[model samples]
Target: MVRVLLVDDEELVRVALTAILDSAAGIEAVACDGPEAVGLARSTAPDVVLLDVNMPGADGFSVLRELRALPEPPAVAMLTLLGSDEYLHAALRFGACGYLLKDTEPHLLIDCVRILAGGGVVYVPPQSRAVMGTHVNVPLPAPAAPELRGRVTGREYEVLALLAAGLSNTEMAERLGVGMTTVKTHIGALKKKLGAPSRVALAAVAHREGLLDTASADRP
Candidate 1:
């Protein structure tokens, strides 16, 4: 069974999400307001946590950081009424395995829990992807000009392109027909070469330096 802790400030939202998750097979859900989330997670030890982005004292990002500090932290997915590039970037930076809108369909929401519980990342529903792409495609300041060319290997460049496209390591492995460890190695190498702090930052750098455009042109 997949145990899920649903955290939200609103009682109604928490109740509704619990019901939806409980209705699904092989899933059990519990609820708490944002303030109580960290405690409940430690006690309940759920496999996944659905955390609200906006809360009274401890917002989702704050709670996410706390939860991750736990000895054996549950996989966390940020739940929000609003979707934006800023939220996506913040969530990813803070170790969120998923970012989902609260208004997501009941079935899809259930599926997202299953995916995260099964060691997959979920940043979908099209709207989130569009927002992520918008932010990544922005004309941010590039790193030095000469530092851009021929820094990453061909495979690493392909991996970088998919990262900019918002594909997770698991998804990238399938797409590239490579193992997850191989994908991770490429990502780590790219991070070092691009001097990016995180995958999100790497994607931003790739866009700013026109690396994704160049990679596209080089592809058959």
Candidate 2:
């Protein structure tokens, strides 16, 4: 079972989210206000944390930073009513594993938690990409070998391409016609070769190095 910690200043919001999470199979959720978030996170050692962006005192960013500083930090997913690029980018910079709109469907919310718990990243509704402008169409330059600082195999290159397209591990597995473990292995290899700290950073490096452009041209 995946243990989840819910952090929100609003009592009603915590109650609603906790109920939703508890009812789902294979999940157990506990709630705390922003002030208590870090302490409870250390004590409970949850697998994932669903954090509200707007809180009365410390706010989400501060809480997120503190949680990430723990010896064994839980994966965090920012839950917010706002879709502002500022908050999204801040959360990513602070080491959040996911960003989700509060109005997301309950089932999808559960799925996002499960994904994060399984060592995957999630940023949903596609519009969330606006924060990084990751999907904006731009004129492509002539194809060249992606300047990967470290050697990466051809199969690793394929995985990186799908990853830059924002596909999750499960999606990558289906696309590659491989097992989930194989997809994860490729992602791990890519992370080491690219020296990326997170999936978001890995995608950013791919864009910066023109890997995305190369991948797009190669797609038939």
Candidate 3:
């Protein structure tokens, strides 16, 4: 059986996650808030831990550090609403094998949990690939993607599409014949407008939103 731990301050979230994971075949799920997490994980020895980043007393990063230090540590992942680079970096630095957005669909969540349990890593917004670069083990996925109609500026959308296509910031600047600063500005705006956390996520969002499909989109 695959043992999974769901950690979140929100009662509803914990319950919901537990139910979802429990419903999956060959998986057993247990949940607790941040303060109770390390203890629960130690006692239960879950195969995978889905930790929440922002919590009252003991935050996710600290708990994650403790979990990784266990004599027989389980695969840990940060599951949070905020998708910022700072949190993503901290999770990786602290040894989280996965960094997932809370808004993730149910099936994808299960797949990520399974992957992490079986000694694998999952990076949410493929853009993290460029930043982290083979630091962890994983496979690339081709998502179905979404539609983006006037949600971002034309330049920003172009940057995002190029980002999805696996172009680095330096590469993108050269491709667009713009200064690095200009490219950075467009990326920042894209993240703010689209609520993406990191450049990797920006790229992931680019593919998720299918920005390339509408390269001719209207700009403001």
lDDT values for all models? 0.82, 0.80, 0.74
Model 1, runs deviating above 4 Å: 1-5, 22-32, 36-48, 65-76, 83-98, 114-134, 137-145, 148-150
TM-score, prediction 2: 0.76
lDDT of 3: 0.74
Q: How many clashes show up in model 2?
A: 0
Query: Model 1: per-residue lDDT, tens digit, 1-220?
Result: 9999999989999899999999999999999998899999999999999999988988789999899889877889999887777788778777687898998999999988887875566886466667566556554444574666656778888988887775766788999898988987897788778876445657778887888888898799
What TM-score does prediction 1 earn? 0.66
Per-residue CA lDDT of model 2 for 1-220, tens digit only, reads 9999999998999999999999999999999999999999988999999999988886899899888888878889899898787787787777688988989999989999988886678887466767656422322232233446336666787888887766767778888899989998888777777666567777777777766666666567
Error of 1 at 116 (Å): 5.4
Residue 191 of candidate 1: its Cα lDDT?
A: 70
RMSD of 1: 4.5
- Which candidate should be chosen as best, given TM-score against the real structure? 2
Give per-model TM-scores: 0.66, 0.76, 0.60
TM-score between candidate 3 and the true structure: 0.60
How far off is residue 121 in model 3, in Å?
A: 0.3
Sort order, TM-score high to low: 2, 1, 3
Clashing pairs in 3: 83-197, 127-200, 128-200
